[model samples]
Target: MQSVALLLIGIQLVYAGKHSLQYFYTATSGLPNLPQFVSVGIVDGQPFTYYDSKIRRMTPRQDWMAKSVGEDYWERNTQASIGSEQAFINNINVVKDRFNQTGGVHTYQEMYGCEWDDETEEINGFDEDGFDGGDFTTLDYKEKRYISPVPQGLATAEKWNRDGSLQQRKNYLGTICVEWLKKYLEYGKSSLQKKVSPQVSVLQKDPSSPVTCHATGFYPSGVTITWMKNGREHHEDVEVGELLPNEDGTFQKTSSITVTPDEWKKNEYSCVVEHQGKSVTEDEIRSNKGDSVPIGIIVGALGAVVLLIIIVVAGYKVYQKKKGFKPVNGSDDGSNSSAHTVPQA
Candidate 1:
């Protein structure tokens, strides 16, 4: 019940009034301190969705998306397209059709968002930042929050909106974003394996001290920084920090604990960091924060039952040897034992 309530709260957050959804896919070739790939849809300040390159599909549309974009748009572009291989590829072309060739650190992003405007009927607006051979460009609707002057020497530039641009009519926009997302998912995490290890440090103010285990400049956001005492995770006096974005697009975090000088001298404390996998295929998963304990217990129980079945089947089997025969007229093999002689009242 608590989880369900929290889920409702979370869903309401993005759809409450109005919010923005920023879709991003990035790939890098040379940055040592950045994530190799990033495919995410950030709604307001939280993660609303992401692309799954492994399966070549966008995530399930939140309720907000259905209400905002209309159900048909959500199903056709995000669900149906990714469900079929050819349709998925066609969707990828939507991004490729607009993006420049990839090299070095390439980033592709789209801004399709909604807001509660009592004065304005809800209309989806889109903006995109794309990489070029040696430069970058922005394409967006006129109503977007950020609008820039077109390049000095561009032959043509196009900006489309549902009602604003006048030249291009926004049609099946959700479908277009899906394909653009596919393009981003293709290369965004190309540098995942090339991540730079965080610079970890334990700091204390005095000899007997509260120490801060600081980890900075690590790529791929879900890195876990843990403080261990004598090789075991310690939580009583430990503080694990959150991921802070570096100016360079990499990430940083810190975990802290307090200990006596004697404990410090004995080296009883250490910091361990677990870096997550990078690829989307065969490696991507949804992080369910509240259900871990119950799910683990359920899976463990099921495993024990399966192990019991294996134990029984692995035992030896006996052969009948043709010596087996039905006793003539139901006679026993000299071993008929009776514990009762009729039921005497």
Candidate 2:
């Protein structure tokens, strides 16, 4: 019985260890870092670009410097095509559809290169030290802005500049970013994706019930958490909720917006959680916390019964030994001789 008990305990510990290991791996590897980039237009309505600022840091001399050193030039000369919004949307939908048709994974790599603006070109002459004005002392154009191709597995959105050059959209730096985005998109489809995928929860409440957003993520501590009503970033009229740690060591947060009972009745309320780097959501989950003490009590009761049985059995064995135990007598007869002998004559 003792052996059996030990075996059972060993088995339970093994099972628990296996479960813990599995959960640890899942929490660590199952999700991808959310790709952060702005969508150009609607997925099915326009051809837009997603420029990854994270990638831009790679060639800081060109990509990073160009933006800051030539901010005005890049902004001014950067052409905006409003008419192509719908066209861009349509193209992206085609790509999405093609991805669906493939039935497995999708791989797409896009490369974009564009010439720096005139003003930026002129500034190339100035080094960390100010240079005196002279043609001989003028700067050299050592760098050309090139966006790396997003490898084979990730879906990306980007824009083409007016001169047929690549513009900033989703910046695909290389393998790491590409792999990260692939995992990210995969999670997005399954409603598990974070990193830019907005955490959305649908609550059936008064149609006028205001919904608020709360956030905390890989983003800096000071990031802003805001509310949105019907998709507008809310400013003045909502309440924010507390931030908590996620099961995966990331962060989970909540916020609420108030409207009216009427809004809630319509079931149109949703909680949108946005942290700096990623966001997750919780909606009307259709369930609440569960009770556990009943099972615990039952287990405790059974353990007590076993312990009592062990104690009672041990006591009975000791009692039986004491009842049958006798001291050796010198005479063969069990009765004492004093009882029968005539005063020891």
Candidate 3:
């Protein structure tokens, strides 16, 4: 039995590391200032293409994406997004009516993507929809059906299933989506596969404030920031923040812990940041306030300044699917938002 369990564990490990390609679409109503429709294309958590109702054109966010694809690709995707914009606008209104919401700001979002495990070459896909900051429907790819979380989505789910859209979705998610993902990966391998170590720092306003451990300028997004007390893991009063994108295309995150000066003096508290298999920790900590300093160190005053400009452009794609807004650089039109493009699968 132990050998069988070990074999299972080993099998699971074969599919551990995965690369994903995803597209996010958001349609909004009742917000005159913001774009009514927005779409974004992402590969391995990096935004590559963006389109909004205001721009009315599909633009490449990454240099590799622009250099690899030609004008026809952009024209094709741009036209598709223009069509999807109208469709999604109708979808939002449909959802609003189903929910009996006559007015007020509402958003309808769709996210579909595929993931490929590098080691095992295993592929998996997902399609989900959200309405007004909540789940509406999700596709069960294995069963080839749509699952509705709310009563308002039941009709949409049944109609989609009855109209034979599931088979089309299944084909897209399994085959076409994976093919596009592979192509994108090939085009952007140099940038996508490159990993950069994070700059870790511990900061505090004064002896009374919570000590914050900030990790910034890391690539590939996956990271772990933890607090340790006396060499063991510390959990109490620790607040882990959301991952935010830096202007330089890297990612930043913060974890803070509240401890009294006396408690910190009595115990050895340290912040550890693990990114891309590298661990960073500082031992000497100093504060702006003239208090008895801790043994650990504080670094990156410059990073703290950069953090002030760090705006959360992309939403938590998996967690809070409603907030899918990203601003493109060098846009004078004052219209920055999120959107999507529909590819025939």
Candidate No. with top TM-score: 3
Better candidate number, 1 or 2, judged by lDDT: 1
The 10-residue segment of model 3 with minimum total lDDT is: 5-14
For candidate 1, lDDT tens digit of each residue in 243-270? 4556554556677676666555565554
lDDT of 2 at 338: 7
Off by over 4 Å in 2: 1-225, 263-345
RMSD of each: 27.6, 37.7, 10.7
In order, candidate lDDTs are: 0.33, 0.21, 0.64
For candidate 2, the TM-score is 0.19
- Candidate 3 residue-pair clash tally: 14
In the range 1-345, model 3's lDDT, one tens digit per residue, is 111111111111011267776677778888898788887777776778877898899899899988976776777677777888877887787788889997888878776766777668888777778887688887787788988888998988888787766766677667766667777788899998777777766688888888887777887775666677876788999999877667788877899899889997798776666555343433322234344536343224311112112111122234535322211111122122222333221
Query: TM-score of every model?
Result: 0.31, 0.19, 0.80
Q: Which 10 consecutive residues of model 1 have the lowest summed lDDT?
A: 307-316
- lDDT comparing candidate 3 with the true structure: 0.64
lDDT leaderboard ranking: 3, 1, 2
